[model samples]
Target: MQETILNIYLVIDKGSVTSFRAKAYEMEGEDSAKIGFLKERATEDFASAFVFDSPKNKKGEYMPYKKFSKLEKQGLQYQLFEEIFEKFRVPQNPLICVTPVVDGEVFGKK
Candidate 1:
């Protein structure tokens, strides 16, 4: 059995800054149905782009964004996206930050 654990972060900057985390899991393809349901929910919730943390290789190097498509490919991103979409009711063009780095320390930081 294999499982992927991700530390998902969502950073939003208005006047101040905010960050959130959501955990997502898929058990060796056995739970794919749940993943699909989440994907559908996300699509119905938003019609804009989703900003994700750059995928990293085994060496911890960032990979290009084009290399990945579906959010489910990165379980954290998928779960975070769905959770935010359902809870926040963010606008269609909302930015879903998926990086471990916090705001104020990065571009969106104060």
Candidate 2:
């Protein structure tokens, strides 16, 4: 398909996790595109406390819990997780990022 850059927002409300995906550069604004999650995570930790990688051994270094995938940040799953936890405490600062998805997975900001 087309190499469309997608801007995604991760929001968690009332314990329910939901993802929002919008066209990176659209006249209609950030609400023009569809909203969803990327089951397929990323290879980098974009700004997460859970995901940490050590250049030496890429195995042990990973997301917060074993439940999370190693590649959750380069992707946007990290943001999603953060939003969910925040919602549990007091939801605020929805995470966002721009990236080209893999058959629709993302995080390669422009």
Candidate 3:
């Protein structure tokens, strides 16, 4: 069995509740060199928020909420993510999902 390697990048914006632009490339081989390359590219390309850490699964996406809630409950981190909920409600920065070049098809058709 063989494993398919994927390259993903994210752009995090700073100011309020950090926003991001995520991109993923599904490629052939897992080149160790490319991992470092991706890290460098992502850092340079995304200007605002710096890379805190690598990406994780979706289910864990909302886990930050739980963690922040605990912190707020325990009086830890001064500001919680929920504190900026109202700001995220604006239209100019509506959430977006972009799936580029899926399975060698740019628009989903081969």
Candidate 4:
């Protein structure tokens, strides 16, 4: 069976410098349930945005945020989760980003 890669990204709005495309955070090979949880968190935090995608498709198609957001209002929620930190750090700003070429070096290493 093919592994599911749940890709999480940060979408800068039209006014921001990085508004052209979504900035990738990390790819997650999690089950649908965990993916759902990640989506839920993103929806609540980023509002109606499809920053999370399945790169397996490779189409780079934008997922309908409204559809997910509408269904979630019916009480979809997660209680607890495990924390795994691999690429989270304060480089130039407090915001957590993983853009290597645009955001500069990872962990500020030369």
Best-performing candidate as measured by lDDT: 1
Tens digit of lDDT per residue, candidate 2, span 13-45? 232222333323222224223222221222232
**Per-candidate local distance difference test:** 0.39, 0.32, 0.31, 0.28
Clashes of 2: 5
Residue pairs clashing in model 4 are: none
Residue pairs of candidate 2 with colliding backbone atoms? 42-71, 44-74, 99-108, 101-105, 102-105
lDDT of 1 by residue, 17-44 (tens): 2334433333344435444444444322
lDDT of 4 by residue, 5-105 (tens): 22233233322223111222433444555455444444233323233322112554432334334544753311000011222321221222222112321
TM-score of each: 0.24, 0.23, 0.27, 0.23
Ranking by lDDT, best first?
Answer: 1, 2, 3, 4
TM-score of model 3 relative to the true fold?
Answer: 0.27
**Clash count per candidate:** 1, 5, 0, 0
| Per-residue lDDT of 38 in model 4 | 47
- List the candidate 2 regions with Cα displacement exceeding 4 Å: 1-3, 26-110
Winner of 1 and 4 under TM-score: 1
- Tens-place lDDT per residue, model 3, 1-110, is 22222222222222121222333333334455445444544433333322233223475442233443476488653222222223333223222222222222222112
Error of 2 at 51 (Å): 27
Give lDDT: candidate 1, residue 42: 39
